[model samples]
Target: MVSSFRHHRRGFFSTLLLLLAVAGCATFVSNISVDVIRHPSNPSSSLPAFHEAPAFRNGDECSSSSATGRVDIVMTLDANYLRGTMAAILSILQHTSCPKSVTFHFLAARPEPEVLANICTAFPYLDF
Candidate 1:
């Protein structure tokens, strides 16, 4: 009976390990799928890039120092990275400070640059 009990324990652990291995594989595959946004045929294709520009009030210089508010800088990325990156950015933003009104700009690249630029520019402070 003791030997049979030991065998049962070993089998249970083996099954548990198998399930863990499968779970680990699924996680790895999910991450790989997220990192692959562009086609493998053309890695040279450039996605629209975003930049932060200083916001200015009317009659204020483009590089004005009159702007006074907390600048909430949110660097948007592909939705795939959104979950993890958002958490990280939020943590940093919680501790960081800036002197301009905070805003969020989502950047993406479809088939045209103009469309992407338009979307990015629609935000109060977005540069593409």
Candidate 2:
């Protein structure tokens, strides 16, 4: 019984030491510093390029009944930021009593299918 207990204790302690060593190595590797390149204008540069949202001509079908009309503004902003902005606009629209118009323009240098789809999903009224 004593020998068995001693053997089990040695095994348990060896396993524990191995685990601690692995943990320490992992910590050391994770703590190693990495340099990241950052530009002074990175924040502004990350923003998608801007262009004016085109105006739609009023047609016979476009009577003022539309709750809100959307125009694709040209920009490189991602869906996450776009969603946040839309949420804010939506909140304001919900709180306001007066007839308010909420519009989103995708101001981008180039057309982005994913971004457009994202915007459309967020705002059903988005007009491409």
Candidate 3:
């Protein structure tokens, strides 16, 4: 019974990883900050409002430059799930030893300027 449970858990985790990988990867996004102006668009790609997350800084023990120990994370920038994405990124920054070392790469089906603006506002110091 214990082995069966373990097998099911492993399968569930593997499926989740595969789903994340299938979302597609993206290149580094430039630093572009502007107010998110909502325009009439399809619901799937429509921009959502979000409050800015506090800028996360590295600890005293870590390198001053963000590039010293960088970690790249890739995710789909779907407006429908943008809030969840923000939450996930915020959670990571809050838990990591050197939040400055983390970078984000976002993939979107269509060009979404508002998405970039929103992210830039939400995470001003983010390397994305």
The C-alpha TM-scores of every prediction are 0.31, 0.31, 0.58
Q: Per-residue lDDT of 59-95 in model 3, one digit per residue for the tens? A: 8888876567889999899767777888888999999
> Which consecutive 10 residues in model 2 have the weakest lDDT in total?
33-42
lDDT of 2 by residue, 1-128 (tens): 99999999999999999999999998876666321222222354432322222232454444365554533333445544754555554554454343123344446656666656544555554343
Cα lDDT tens digits for candidate 1, 84-122: 444454444344343233355555543444434434443
Candidate 3 or 1, higher TM-score: 3
Top candidate on TM-score is 3
Model 3 C-alpha RMSD to native: 15.1
Off by over 4 Å in 1: 38-128
